[model samples]
Target chain A: MTLELKDVSLRFGADTHIYPTSLTLDPGSFNILLGTTLAGKTTLMKLMAGLEKPTRGEVWFSGRNVTGVSVRSRNVSMVYQQFINYPNLTVYENIASPLRVARIAEAEIRKKVESLAELLKLSPMLERRPGELSGGQQQRTALARALAKDSDLVLLDEPLANLDFKLREELRDELPRLFADRDCIVVYATTEPTEALLFGGNTACLHEGRIAQFGPTGEIYRAPKDLVSAQVFSDPPINTVTVTKRGGEFRLADMAAWAAIGEFANIADGDYTLGVRPHHVSPLARGENPVGIDGKVLVAELSGSESIIHFTMHGATWVSQSHGIHPFEVGSQAKLYADMSRAMLFDKNGTRVAA
Target chain B: MNNKTINHAAWIFVLPVVALVAFNAIIPLMTVVNYSVQETFGDNTFFWAGVIWFEEVLHSSRFHDALLRQLAFTFTILAIEVPLGVAIALAMPRKGAWVSVCLVTMALPLLIPWNVVGAMWNIFALPDIGLLGRGLNALGFDYNFTRQPGDAWFTLILMDVWHWTSLVVLLAYAGLVSIPDAYYQAAKIDGAGSFAIFRFIQLPKLKRVLTIAVLLRFMDSFMIYTEPFVLTGGGPGNSTTLLSIDLVKIALGQFDLGPAAAMSLIYFLIILLLSWVFYTLMMRSEAQ
Candidate 1:
């Protein structure tokens, strides 16, 4: 089903949980709600599922105003972050509960439950109770239950957040294919930018109960509309420096000037915030025509194939992520360079300045 | 992890409780065991009985009748109270200022002394002037609890239910409130009706509390004495004479201490066995 929110907002007593926001979810598409904690992702999903009534505005599902409809009347299924299954029921019974509620025939319930268990890799543990299974298996039972309902919309609220890193990685790779051919709108909420990127769907970036940007996931990651979107969408955090823009030249902290790229010619000369991702900022002499800066290394952390270097320059601490091992001792001086063509600029109001 | 040296002196702290139990429970129980195995008469003179009292009480028709009545009463109350309590708990408001109000009201019945509860029901169900009795008679029913055996049983069961169902309600309410909201939300999204929600979520969650409620009520009702003794005095032709009342009559009223002590031991054993069975069954299902 196509789900649309027309200027929906939610207020809990004196605190506003969600500002007025409108979004339309295409049917049978995977949609990702990406944000940090307390960014109103769960609230938005709850409103869409009819679990909470919006304080104002309407919720439309396929042209019907369902803002006041009860959750039981809506054809939707939700899996919570905490593994939630009927504790007294076996895994097979948990997956079959919804079908039983609908009074489906016994044969159909068995078939559907078995298929979902196979898909989620829970078939071997179907007879075991929820408490007896591992956390990942329990969450997979919850997922299978949600899938067996065959509802029009499936809402997952950070369903894999509680699992360990190895299990999370495994499930993250399998989720897209699990829901690939289902004729339902799948909405997944996550705080991990990498998970959102891997899901490869439409993403709505939220910040402090407001939608900062919403578009195709890859496009939004590549070109965020504002500084907040960039900060929310980046994992290691984008590197930013206050710079003054003069005609054809950009001065950093009034210390050094660099010729502006041809794409930035139309920007009027004024103060602007320059943002460069850590991957684009690296050790000097590594890239052609790179902008160089001097800094004292504060900390260096090497993990797997990359090293994250924390350094202080121009009275501000900045991070540089470089490939391979680059052992820069603390308090040691090092030269860093940033690829000018990959840098982003924002105005004083935090809006991105288009190239 | 903090590694600390173990102190053997911790046993000293528990000595007071051990002494209290020895005085209160062990001494009294030993006295009853002594009485059961020997015959006692005036001046504290004792003679060896060698389980004769146990044989007499076990073979007596009076003991059989009292045991049957006790079982009937216990099972009846369990049947009525468990479901009724859960229903009332489900109907209670989950939040707001009214929750405390409901709780306080439910606790009122439990706070009254057992004798006072029996006396109050006795006066309230008097057929001549009591409201319930007069009202039922006026509505064209012969409802005289003091004169008829069936009416006496009816009034006795009703009094016990009114006095004790609140305990079950409180326990079930506690169980209901501890369930997280996510379960309800998931049930709703799964298109479950109210009955389905209760069957799948609320009932399963309440299993532990209900087990506790059932076991406590069973033990309490089995040893019920004061209330019925105060209300009917096991009268109306001994219709409401439960085992505890019968035991008291044997030990105190007629001073037949031998049979009474034997019956008391048997009573304790029965309660222990039944409660063990109940707890084991409940915990076993929960483990699964």
Candidate 2:
């Protein structure tokens, strides 16, 4: 089924939770709501699920307007982040509850419950209650129950957020494949940029109760419509600096200048904000037309395969993430390279002007 | 190497509580034990007796009658009050200004003194002039609590239910409110009907609170005293004479100390045993 949200907006008294936005999600591709905490992801999901009604719009599903319909009337399933399950029921019964509510035959219920339990690797603990299972196992039970419903719309609100790191990795790898063959509209919400990129479907970047951008996941990441979209799609946070364009060159406040090249040369920039991803700004020069930037090292974090250096440049803190461990001491001078060819320039109002 | 120091100094901190318990519970209980085992008359005199008092209290049909009556009253009130309280709690508004109003109204009956409740019900149910008594009489029903043992029992049970059902309502409401909203939302998305929601979600979540409510009401109703004493006075015969009232009649009215002491111990033991059984059963069910 195709789920469509048309001009939907939600407001609580004087505060707005979701602005007027339209989105249409198809069955074959996974849809993602990407945002930071309290960025209206959950509220938007609730509107789509009919858990909450929009103050101003209608929800359409498969050519029918389902606005104001109760969630129980709609074939929808949701798995919460808190690993919510019926605490008093065994895992098998918990998975069977929806089928029972649907009044499926006992034999069919047992078959579906057994197959779901086996798929979730919970067959060994089918008789155990939710209280007796580990966090991951309990969440798996919840997921199993949701899957057993076989609804046309399934909403997952950060299902792996509460699991431990290794458990999250395991479930994350299995999630996409689990929903692959099902002809359903899957809406997954997350605050992690890496997770959104890893899913690689249709992404709707939500920022401060507004859809900053929505398109194919890779396309949105590679070419954000605005600075807010870029900011919402970055993990280490995209670095930005405002500069003036005059006489075929961009001039910074510190008197450093660079000849505008490629897309930069074609834009008429009075005062524009330049955004560079952390990886694009490295301690060593690599990309074409690299520009040297000097700053005072503030913090240096080294993982096994990455070096993230935080430095102060032009009175603003900037981060440089690259491979190999580069130990830069605090309060020491450091020079980083920014690839001008890869930088994104935005207008004064935070609209992307040039790549 | 096991190296743990015994802290005798901790006893000093607990000394006050120990002394308080000793003076209030231990001393009074020892006095009862003394009375249970000995025959006492005037002038602070005592005669050493064995288990004669226990045997007498155990064998007396008067004691058996009162015990039966007490069990009947306790179970009847439980059967009526628990479900009624849960229904009232469920009907209450889950949020907004009405919640506090409902809570305060539910608490009003519990705040009244036991004897005052009894006296209020007595005046309210008087066959000659009280509102409820006259209203029932005018409605073509023959109801006089003072003259009929069945009417007395009915009034007594009605009064007790009114006085105590609020306790269960408050506890059940507390349990109902403490459940996270996500469960209900999930249940809605799962296509659960209202009854199924209650049976699987609300009822199981209420188990702990209901257990506490049942245990408290059971203990309270089983040992009820002043209300029945003031309302019925164990009167219209011995029909309304519960265990505690009968024990009081024996000890204070007829001055039979030995038998009263033995009966008191037995009553205390019954309450303890029943409460333990209830707690263990409820906790075991939770464990599964």
Tens-digit lDDT track of model 2 for A211-308: 99999999999999999999999989999998899979987786367889888888885999989999999999879878898999999999998999
lDDT of 1 by residue, B103-142 (tens): 9999999999999999999999998889999989999999
C-alpha DockQ of every model: 0.59, 0.70
What digit string (tens of lDDT, one per residue) describes model 1 on residues A231-318?
A: 9998788889899988788989755678886677788999999998888888855554478889999999999889899898898788
Clashing pairs in 2: none
Q: Could you say which candidate leads in DockQ?
A: 2
Model 1 chain B: lowest-lDDT 10 consecutive positions: B187-196
Taking the tens digit of each residue's C-alpha lDDT, what string does model 2 give over B183-287? Answer: 999999988878978998999999999999999999999999999999999877999999999999999999989888988898899899999998999899887
If scored against the real structure, what TM-score would every candidate get? 0.87, 0.93
Query: Which candidate achieves the best lDDT against the true structure?
Result: 2
Model 1 error, position A238 (Å): 5.2
